[model samples]
Target: MAKSDKKPGTRRDILNRLKSNGCSDATTLAEVLGVTPMAIRQHLYDLQSEGLVEARAEPRPVGRPAKLWYLTEAADRYFPDAHAELAVSLIDTIRSSLGENALQALVLERSRHQTVLYRNAMEDAPDLRRKLEALAEIRSREGYMAGVEETAEGLVFVENHCPICAAAKACTGLCAMELQVFADALGPGYDVSRTDHILAGARRCAYHVTERETVDG
Candidate 1:
């Protein structure tokens, strides 16, 4: 939901704000965009009518209930999940024909292939931070809009977008495979586990990565 690929004052801009800031009112949105609250209200109304966003009332004790805007489940389609039409269709057909066990096996095979590709990109990353950075770069290249957060405990790998979300949802095994791939790529020096998943309704995919006993989060 970033504005990098979109111009200011567009629907994308509004959505990006709500995405990063959680639910917000028109005044807050106008202040952020330097626009009139009326203009922001129009945008919010349009988005709400389109079912992309939903507005809620928040009581402030004295004034009218403030209108807070947030994205609807339908808005998830606007995120990074691209290149998925054919992929999901093909996966659906495979699963329908081959059965669940075969699909799981297929996911494992695909994970191994992905692991190799990630390993190549991360092979030279010596430190824990470097490895996290390298993995983020690789994911960004694949349209995940990935980034790293350095905390006192460990490096948090956050992917704000998932380009293959449709495929992953069609087969949750894809998510499991991704966790395994991350662990393998980083080797035994670190433990990698997902704390947030977009499929589980989280805004992003977040991982708690611990390096040895020093970095735990």
Candidate 2:
């Protein structure tokens, strides 16, 4: 039997594309999704009416301008956030009741646990790519929207979204410890360093992984 053609709802797919790749125009979106431009525009109109998307005009080299569509802040409701409000509240309570040192201890403990879990998950993998893929799968299951990609620079681990954004903002130490956790989790010969940080006002978090002759971690 021939394979059936099926796909996600157009609106959801559009939102997801915008979330992953940032702003885009309907023509570009249609091409990527194998749909007609008119269909994409219709969905964009509905999304805009629902306050989930918006568009701004950009100058074109030979034409008037192009309408570039992008997700609005309100669209964040569609993505997983790992109970942001509750996480932030817990972070606040821990800091207020126990103090800074206690919070630091808590963050460190969390990092240690994460490192152990990641290391164990990647232990059976045969190579660096396999290990990174294992790590990506684990993180994706944890709501990070993570994946591993090969680029000109090196192997890159990309987290398109941070589900614990609120909690991380409440305690920056969580962010700091994450770097150490990654370095330790990947083991001795690999060096994992973050090149992009969402907390630092970037769209997402990305880490560069490179094999070194010797690594301190």
**Which model scores highest in lDDT?**
2
Candidate 2 residues lying further than 4 Å off, grouped into runs, are: 1-8, 57-66, 214-217
Give stretches of model 1 more than 4 Å off. 1-9, 24-38, 57-67, 83-85, 150-153, 214-217
Q: What digit string (tens of lDDT, one per residue) describes model 1 on residues 11-59? A: 7789877765569988888778766777788888999999999988899
Scored by lDDT, model 1 comes in at 0.83
| Shift in Å, residue 137, candidate 1 | 2.4
CA lDDT of each candidate?
A: 0.83, 0.88
Give the per-residue lDDT digits (tens) of candidate 2, residues 92-211: 998899998999998888999999999999999998889999999999999888889899998999898888888888899988888889999988889988999999978789999998
Give each prediction's root-mean-square deviation over alpha carbons. Answer: 5.1, 3.6
Count backbone clashes in candidate 1. 0
Pairs with steric clashes in candidate 2:
none
Shift of residue 105 alpha carbon in model 1, Å = 2.7
For each predicted model, how many residue pairs clash, with residues at least 3 apart or on different chains? 0, 0
Model 2 weakest lDDT span, ten residues long? 1-10
